[model samples]
Target chain A: MKLSELPFNTQAKIISVDKKIISRVAAMGVIPGTEVKIIRASPLGDPLELEIKNYNLSLRKQECKLIEVEKI
Target chain B: MSKNLALIGNPNVGKTAVFNELTGQTGHVANWPGVTVEKKTGKMDKEFDVIDLPGVYSLSPSAIDEMIARNFIVKDKPDLIVDILDATNLERNLYLAFLLKELEVPIIYVLNLMDVAKKRNIEVDVDKLAELLGAPVIPTVAIKGEGIDAVKTKIRKIFSDGKLAQKSSIPVKYSKEIEDKIQRTEELLKKDAPHFLSDKRRWAAIKLLEEDKEVIKEISASPNGIVVIENVKRFASGSEEFDLAGERYNIISEIIGQTYKRDKDMITTSDILDKIFLHKYFGIPIFFMIMWSMFEFTFRVSAPLGTLIELGLGALGDLITIAWPEDAWYTSLVLDGIIGGFGAVIGFVPLIFTMFLVLSFLEDSGYLSRAAFNMDRLMYKLGLHGRSFVSLILGFGCNIPAVMSCRAIESEEDRLTTILVNQNISCGARLPVYVLLGGFILGDGATGTIIFSLYFLGIVIAILMALFFKKVIFKGETAPFILELGDYRMPTVKYTGIHMWERGREFIKKAGLIIFTVVVLMWVLQSIGVDPDTGLLAWGTDPENSLLAGIGHLFQPLFAPLRWSWIAAVGIVFGFLAKEVVVAAFGLILAGEEEPEGLGKLVVGNLAVAGVAAAAMPALVYGYLVFVLLYTPCVAHLGAVYKETGSKKWTLVSATYGIAIGYILALIINLIGGVYF
Candidate 1:
């Protein structure tokens, strides 16, 4: 499933990232095998904040959709 | 021998605080990323030269800050890399450390925010971590000045003993397959090793395999480089970069597993705060309320202080006028040109400082990021994401830094749009003009409302222009909003005070140089002209025949639709130099006719003389304020825009757009107001 489709607080392991921003997303420590939890979505819900490796990162739902993930 | 120590870290890891603590240099440390966009250098204990680099998550350069940090580390080749890590988030930060380790620089690992980490029951075994990383690991609460001496001692030891490099651990190992490919690539690179100047061939080979653009460009320029690149590319199946990153994380996890421990159930204070601060319903309103209170605080607190400054300048002007002979050219020049023109701009120092004080507080407290996050929805409509708003908010303080801060925006189109629209935000320099005109036209009771409305109008217009430009001029995809919301911390009075003073100092410097020169030139133009009747040179005699009047007449027609007179036209022209000069030009123009009690009175009297009727005064002033609000930013901001855009064509486009928008908006406001009021 796409990372953005995960419900709030759901923990998932990243499977793959889209080619366009794979390096950028990975550089922020969101590589494959990393367990990420949906922290909070913006009030409008277009952007979602996630917790990975004890740090919070907010990314647009569009960008989030590019990351493939599986529920852990 | 003194060594250059480069401080590197992930954003918001307190790298700058560590730099400040080590070097005793105030480098605008904030809770946000990209505050230190440029590298700052200072001497540490007269032994090491400390360079504070912009924080980056990894050496792979995707953003401007990351590019700067990567370029500096590779090109500058500092002797020692002081890698500052946030102890609370070692797993994420250690990835960068691993990357830096590949650069082969002697590393001093400084784990900052130990206090915060401990609060959440995150304990790091400093000695074990040091042994694993093969570097001196010092735990510090940078804000509280803990472990600073230990860091200094380590630096001193490195300089004296030169033992750090030998003691450093081997770089993180990749998986077997990746390791085989890297060894092969490194061996291939060894044949052309002379081109690799930094002796970081392993790093270069890995980057080449990872297809790092800068490294590829470097290698591709050399002989037989394409063959090597092709070979490296063939070794990895399509996912080598991800595999490499995953391998690094695996190593980091091992190190973290051995040396780090934390309470699983301890919720951070930031998480608690975010519940209310980032509340879906209340976030934006709370942001605006805070902003409103900030402006209210600025205007209310500065009013009395502004009055005091005005009184002092008035006394100084009187003293200058009395000390010189009556009717003398020097007397007029000193009192009218120097005191009148310069004092008008300087009178708002109190307001500027107050506004900056509050802004610095917001910036340092990390609330500014949350505010940007709240505005993401609105900003998204304008082809900009949330981070663009940070630059716009900085625009309120000054457009120069705001334009410079556009470097932080990842998208080229969004950044340029931000730079172009930033000038409309009613900068602090433009505040005095608003307060002066708004107070004159709408009375004290409505001054705040008028000011707020003008600011709101500026934002609205900026949004419209951004949408138009995005669709028509520079069409592209908006970069996704990816920002780290930093933890909210109590702002220190000392830091805010220093920030306020730094910005206020820039304003004063402009007054001393740009304002002073422009005022003198204005005085010269007003004082010298051919006598229209006799055709004789009339120096400071016939005011109607002055050069300024001639220039004003030429420009007055353009602004005539808004009902602005020739003098106001001249003021607007001078305003291009700096916005405050509009008020100053008016003061200088009416200097001899009357010593108006205040700037508001002088502006009011001038409007009446300009043939603006009493009923239309408010409307005309609002229209004129709109023009000033949208017009081309001051010369300093234009220079910044040019520098930021790196294209004169875009600069001209921005300037022309601003003037056209200003004229059209002013005309619209005037025509609508004429029909109603």
Candidate 2:
């Protein structure tokens, strides 16, 4: 499911990363089992502020869809 | 000679903190060897020398910084190479390590931020990994002084071993067909060129197949050039060859998997902290507030010190005026020209240092990476790299280091874009101009508002300038920015203070060296005149008489369109030479009481007396400030542009474009206002 489709403040677990997200999501140390949290979403649902581990990482709308997530 | 060991790594990887721990002396910040790659090198415990090169990803050798790091490792050949790696992101870092191993130098990997790694439940056996690569690996938390001694001892052992070239036997994983193709390419390269290329030909061939420009450039320059490249590219399909190139990653991933296992963790400290900083409602406002506070603190907190320095310089000028009363020419030279020029600049040390202090704190705490992520959208629209904001922020302190920070940019076009527009950001030297103009227009109470507006104008101009330059000189789509948003960590006060002091010292040194000489020259020009009795008449006294007066009158027509008096014209021209020179020129030529106490009042009085309306002062002041903020950079910054871009054409283009835009903008303001007022 698209990350923007998730409800705000919902915690999600990343299941698999596809090749489309290689540029943005790949360098960020995002892999299977990495816990992700949606802290805030922009009004347009483009850049979503996320909490991954100890840091807040922002990903563009297109980059967010590459990570297939399972609701915890 | 103490054997120097430069600790090279990407920025925010705890390099400086590690340098401080190793050296035990305050580290000094300066340009890297040959270029303005902001480097920090110090004597380590009085025996070993540790130089910190600016952060870079690959030694592909496209930019000045990459060249500097590549040259240093290849030429200077430090006794031992300590490649510090962020443990959290080993994949990307290990890519560089593989390249470093090929340098044939003894390299010891320092896995920093191991504490952060432990939090993620990712575990690695350092010894096993070290054995696999034939290099020593030591886990360290540089901020906490952990494992430094062990790293240091290992470094000594590396020196003793005389840098025994460790032939890396770690094979890359490629398909059988690709491996056979690479073997053929390697044999051909070995036969064609044995001593010309440093890296293995197989690797070079692979890179060529991947369309790496740097590798292609080397091959084209070689004996069998075009044919060899055509053969390599023709052998492997583009996508297949590219996968083969990434074979290094496949091998590394399997190796890491063998030594490490990953698990799920509930929460990371970075996540908990981001809850507040990245809050949707509060994020943008909080960022603005923090920025506002930084500017406020820089000026207000440093005001007392700035005032004290101004007074001290004034007193010194007075003493010099009194000391050589008979040598009027020499005395005026010392008092009006030299001291006046430097005094005007020295007063800004506090603001300069404070800006550096704030940036250092943000950078050391790893908050700057987050800032890049936040400002990316705004910067992208401006035709610049997102990391350019970091350079622009650094420009607040000084333009020299700011230009150097352009190394973080990966694309040539974006790098040039950042360098060209960087000076639009108000530098410390321009602070006095801001303070004086802001005070003149808005009074002391509104000084903060005026100053803030000038700074904002700088940002706006930078964005516009980037758009203009890209459309004209550089025409291309900027390579999309891909950056790792590092987690925020608590900044170490010790390093922050030390870093701030280092920047402060550079400003003070520049003031002493450049300002002192300019002041002396100004004094000599005015003092040694035919009629020694009356002293040099301040410019515009007789219009036809006095060197400065004649020059100011000649330039008067040009500035008339900007609604400036001959005196203000002189001030603006001097400003182009050096922004602080504007204040000194006004103080010397226009503020006529031999020595004026309040510079802002002096400036106001001169303009008011010259038929420049009191109300027009604000418009004129804002207009003039805008011109300076967006105008041609001083000689030092231009020199930096030349060094960073390594092109005289770009340097000339940047300077000419800035001045043309500044002059046109200043003229537009006056033309509209003259008809109205």
Candidate 3:
């Protein structure tokens, strides 16, 4: 499943990220093989907040859809 | 040699608070990131001048701020760097610090918000973390001035000990494949491009493998640099960029596992608040409630004080009238030029002060990030960020500070778009034009609806222009919305107060000076003309002979389609001093007409004398309001635009674009109204 479709609070690991956005998101420690979870979605429900590397990062669904993920 | 110390951090990490403590300079600090859009410098004693650069998550130049921080770190090469970190968010905060390690500069790590970390039950072994990063760490609550002396003492110690910062080992070594690629570039640089070589060659090698454009541009200055780059491009895989950043995180996880401790399951106040503030259904309503309350607090509370300043200035003018009892040129200069020009700015003091005070509090409390996070989805559709929403709402209060607040927007394209469209938001000063004119021609019953329509029109135009600019001018991919919804802490009064005063004081100094000069210059222009009888230059107040009236006649034909006279043309031109002055200009410049008992009637009564049909006057007033709503901002607004943008191109775009659009829109309004009553 894409990271955008992951259920809230369900643990997952990033399988592979699109090369277009890997550097920026990966810079914050969201890389392949890292455990991640969707903590919350923002008010309008487009930007999802993910808990990874002991911090919360907000990314819009447009970017999140590019990341391929699998349930852990 | 005079040395410099630089402060770098992620946004909302108390970096500017640390800056203020070290330099004794008061720049604004808030929970929002990128508050220090441009670097600020101050004397840290006679020897060291401290520089504060805007926060960036990484050294890659994806945006203007990233470019700014990267250039300072690479080109200026400050002697020492102070990396401020949020202790609770250790792994992510250290990401930039890890990147800085590649610079090979001596660093003193400042771990701020330690109290918040402790409350979250996170334990940081300071000594171990410092050793892992190869730096001295001092934990601080920078807003409270805690651990500040330790940071200063360590800076002194590092500067005194000259023989340090040697390359001990590789910084977070990548896999063997990428390592070989780095070695190839490093060896090439040390041999053929010695002219461009430094201790940062290893960093440049890593950047070359990552295809970092700024570093590539630097190395390309030497001819051999192309050969080196082409050589690397042959054997190197494109995934080295991901591998390198991945390796750094791998190393960081190892460091955190050993030295950092935390309770991951503990729910905190920020989370609870976010549940309501970022609620699926209620979030936007709550956000707007807070915004409306902020608006109410700014104007409703400051209205009396604003009136007090205006009345006080009036009484002083009355006193001068009583004391001299003479109709002299000096009296007019003092009353209209000096007092009138400067007094209008002083009236803004209470309103601007309270507006920033509330905004600073919102930003410092961590609610601003939530506001942006919630608003970003809507704003992103409009080609702006969630953060631009705050600046736009603040524009309703005044556009000067609204433009200044755009600093927190990281992308240059988004920020410029926000500033360009901000003036259409219809500020408080513009309200006087709407209310005073709406009542006289249309009566008191229609005034409220007219004011509402003009404001609604301003917002619609602002949204349309934003979309227009995005599709045509900016054309960059919609900006990414990556934000850290940081923990909310109780904001300290001392910090918020200082932030308010510091930002408000900027309006007084920069915008204030511009308003004063234009007001006085307008006075001089209205006073001088070719003497009607002598046919020579002379100082007089005759409306038919003055230069201002002549300029008014010049532009009168442009508005002739709207049925406005030359006198109205003169008022619009004088409105440039500030929007609030347009009403007073009508009262001052309408000579030889029966001065009606009230201002609204005076403005309305004179339009008929200028060839506007009595039936068409009301419709023309609507066109006039539309023109005022869209036209160029006041001089004070332009002064602020120039000061913040520091680019003559953007400021000139702001000045000219609005007048063109305003003219076209107003003409459309008049033509359509010509069909009806």
Candidate 4:
């Protein structure tokens, strides 16, 4: 499923990221093998905060949709 | 031998904190450098020159900060690269450290935030990590000055030895295929560009494989460069960039597995706090509440201090009046021109410092990022990304820094739009005008509400203009928001004090330089009068016949819709010099009229004489307040916008847009109020 569709607080592994932002996403430590947890969605539920590599990152829902993740 | 050391790290890794601790110089060490977009250089014990570059996640330049960090390392080639790694998040931070390793400089790995890591039960085997990375790793709690001496001693040793000392000569190896590709590229570079191969051929090779445009451009300019690039591209499979990053992560994960240990089940303090702070419904309200309290705290705590400075300046002016001989040119110059004009601007210093202190606290505490996170949806609706909200909040303190801080926004269109709309946000300089007008119309009881409404109005107008610009002028796709939410930490007193003092010093400098000269020129213009009978220039005569009045009369019609008199017109025109000068202008013009009274009384009396009825006072005052709120920012801010955007067209657009919007808003307010009141 798209990473944005993952329920809050659920753990997932990033499978692949959209090519346009793949390098940026990978540089930020979100690669195919990294385990990520949706820590929290923003108040409006559009931007989702994810915990990856023991650090927190907030990404917009549209951008999050670009990342294909497998629910673990 | 070079003595330069560059501090490189990911965002929120306490890189600047370590720089400050080592150099004893505060270089805006906040949770993020994206907000403070400037490199700082300082001396380390008079031997090593420490340069703090902006934080970056990788060597690749996506944002301006990354571009700067990468450019400095490649171009400047500092002797020692102090790669700061957050001990708690070593796995991610080591990604950048690996990139720095490619730069082929002598690197000292500083594992900062050791205290926080320990508190969270995260431990690192310093020796093991050092062995793997082939550098010396020093664990530090920079805010408390731990491990700083070790860093300094290492630097001293490097200087004494005249060569870099390493624990090991290990190199990070990628997969066989990637390694083969890199070796081929390196061989080609060495053959075709032997001059450039001495220092960082490995880095250039890797970048070529990753297809870094800048690196490709540099290499393609050399002999056989195009042939080498074409050869490299043909050999690379799917995506070499992703492969390099994944391989780096593999190396980092292996090292971290051996050296790092953490209590995986324990929830961090940041996560616990984020539960309440980032709550879907409560987050935004909590953000507003914090902001409201900060504003209240700023005004309440600084009000007495502001009055104290005013009274002190007033007494100093009184002394000057008594000491100087009456009717001498120096008398007016010293008392009115120097003390009256500059003192008015300087009097706001205490308040400005208080606001800066609160802002610094927010920034250092890491709440500013959360505020941006909460406001992301709303900011998105306005066609600006979430990060622009940080610059907007900064606009309340000062617009010059706000405009400059737009560098943090990754997209060019969004940054420029933020800069253009930032001027509408009521800055600290405009607070005095609001206070005076609000107090005149609604008295002290409603001053808070009035001022709050004006600030709110400025924000609304700013957002509307941003949307309009996004749709019409600078049409483009808005960059997707991706922000790092850092850990919440208590702000160090020294850091906060230095930040507050830096801003206060800047404001004082402006008062002494720009405001001081502008006020003197204003005094001269007001002093020169034209005699009606012969049209001969007369000095220190009736202000009604002065050059300033004639100039005021020319612009008076523009403000006629808002019912502003000639003096008010003059005040608003000179306000372009500095917003604080608006109040000083009124004082100067009124002092020339008759016996000077309290500013509040003068404003009320002037409006009464202008035939402004009590019923229409609120609307007129509100309209004037909105005008001041939306008008063109001070000259310093305009200069900042020009410098930041590097386009005269954008600067002119910003100024003209502000004036047009302010006039239209005021006219609408007047027309609507005339019918109701």
Question: How does model 2 fare in lDDT?
Answer: 0.69
Report the lDDT tens digits of candidate 2 across residue range B1-677. 78878687755677776777787765666766565556777886577878887676566555566678877876687777788887776765676676666455667788898888898886888988888667788999988899989987877776666654554234444678777776777766777666446455556655665566676787788887777777776666755433532555555666677766556455667766566665556766777888888887877788899889878887887687567774455565556565565566667767778888887887777666656666766776676766888888888878888898887777788889998889888888888877876777667788888888888878888888888877777887765445555667777787788877777776677667665665555544444333444665453233225566555667888876666666677766666666667777766664235434477776766542256656666667767777877776587888889998999999998888777887787667655555226
Cα-based lDDT at residue B502, candidate 4: 74
Give the alpha-carbon lDDT of every model.
0.82, 0.69, 0.78, 0.82
Residue pairs with backbone overlap in model 4? none
Give the higher-TM-score candidate: 2 or 4. Answer: 4
Best by the DockQ measure: 4
For residue B653, what is the lDDT in candidate 1?
A: 83
iRMS of each prediction in angstroms?
A: 1.3, 5.0, 1.2, 1.0
Candidate 3, residue A45: CA error in Å?
A: 3.2
| Model 3 pairs whose backbones collide | none
Q: Rank the candidates by DockQ, best first.
A: 4, 3, 1, 2
Candidate 3 chain B minimal-lDDT segment of 10 residues: B27-36
Q: What root-mean-square deviation over C-alphas does model 2 reach? A: 4.8
Q: For model 3, how does the per-residue alpha-carbon lDDT over A1-72 read when each residue is reduced to its tens digit?
A: 999999999999998889988767877777898889998888677899898887778999988899989998
